[model samples]
Target: MQLTVFPAPTSPTANLDHGHDHGGCRTKALQTAEQLCNNRGVRLTPMRRQVLELIWESHRAIKAYDLLDRIKPTTGTAKPATVYRALDFLLEQGLIHKVESLNAFIGCSFSDHQHQQLLLTCIRCLEVEERPAAGVMEAIDRELEQAAFIIHHKAIEIHGICIRCAKHPPITATI
Candidate 1:
């Protein structure tokens, strides 16, 4: 999966949600995170930040179940509701987005900006990633016009095995 571990310049800065952050990147993301939370009048509780951080740490999209496993405390365990609520809040704020096909979520790289997103999922590996497809919207518009239909916000996603998967068999079979 293409993780793009670091945030791009054009996107609203957020703490990396994946593996680990070093140097100034983490600081910038944390600052941005605080600002966003303040502006939205939402509390960035410890649990919430931890969840978001875990998502940022990996460049790849993460399933909620996997995330729960990652974030479960060493001493005790977190309940499903805990992870679900944090994810729900993050999604509501547009700080992250869900890839319906993969049943996974990724940090919103462009949280501070406005744009539509399209996801490309690797079917075999089940990796989820996104790219901006402004032109695709125009094509979609044409298709929709032919159907004489109106559309709401659209999240166009394609699912298939990626080149990596095609070249190298995964250790485990796909579900």
Candidate 2:
């Protein structure tokens, strides 16, 4: 028998269904990352910056190899290890998040500060929206305390149909 465990459900509704200014969001995230890296005395190398840019290009979770392939056109002879190293650096600096469930990465806007969050992935569009679920995280912490458990890491990924998709699904052509 196999056992599968899923994270607890998050907030009931989607908050990013409306028009999203991805241009502004991308700029802000890159600026914040640069500032954080500068403050921490860390180098946001060109490769790392590129990786972060790719992650922020869409709301969807992206795998490392996908990053590698996407980067190859601009960066010649890019290797998996090189991308992984950049990913490690980004993860260490909290500039990006690794969505374990999807085995992918996503940029974090609140990387400058420490906070618990949950990712709401749209099943239809495959877009991932990050939401700060303080209440849910607090409840989890309480449960952990009661269980006398120590948390080394924390992240919650909830998969469902986003409001945008639910409200206005893509029109399919008749066969």
Candidate 3:
């Protein structure tokens, strides 16, 4: 499936809503995960589903520790290992991407694994937006090919302030 990439708003005051359906987006991600697991003959356990849901519930990237903390209240016995294992599974299945700089995980907006993606991270809000980076990948591949190198896994992260955060800076406290 092809995912449409939305360009950044040209004006600061633009509504910025490109017809995104939040609830539907979450549901679609879950459904895509389930379908992927089924196709691979792997089971998406209840714990995995719960973890995926938690990650999709927020647009911001989430650390594994934060996931464990959130799960603890519901499971009453959640552990870091449990969350990590779930994250590993999701990562292996390409259902999520790990942001190395932030040490956090974000649900993959695209289901296809044929291409690499570039993540735009907001330094202030810690929110992440994914955009297809086919051109970037192609350039990397060309350079790697010249060097006789191969890429097994790839994710590029660009740090910047999102338009929303740029337009309205976060409030600061005065001592």
lDDT of 2 by residue, 59-126 (tens): 77789999898889998899999899999999999888888899998888688786558888887767
lDDT (tens digit, per residue) of candidate 1 on 66-167: 878877764167888989999998887777788876688877766767546877777554445567777887888899999999887777789876665566
Looking at model 1, how many pairs of residues clash?
11
Report the poorest 10 consecutive residues by lDDT, candidate 3.
9-18
TM-score for each candidate, following the candidate numbering: 0.68, 0.85, 0.82
lDDT of 3 at 5: 34
lDDT of 2 at 12: 17
Better of 1 and 3 by TM-score: 3
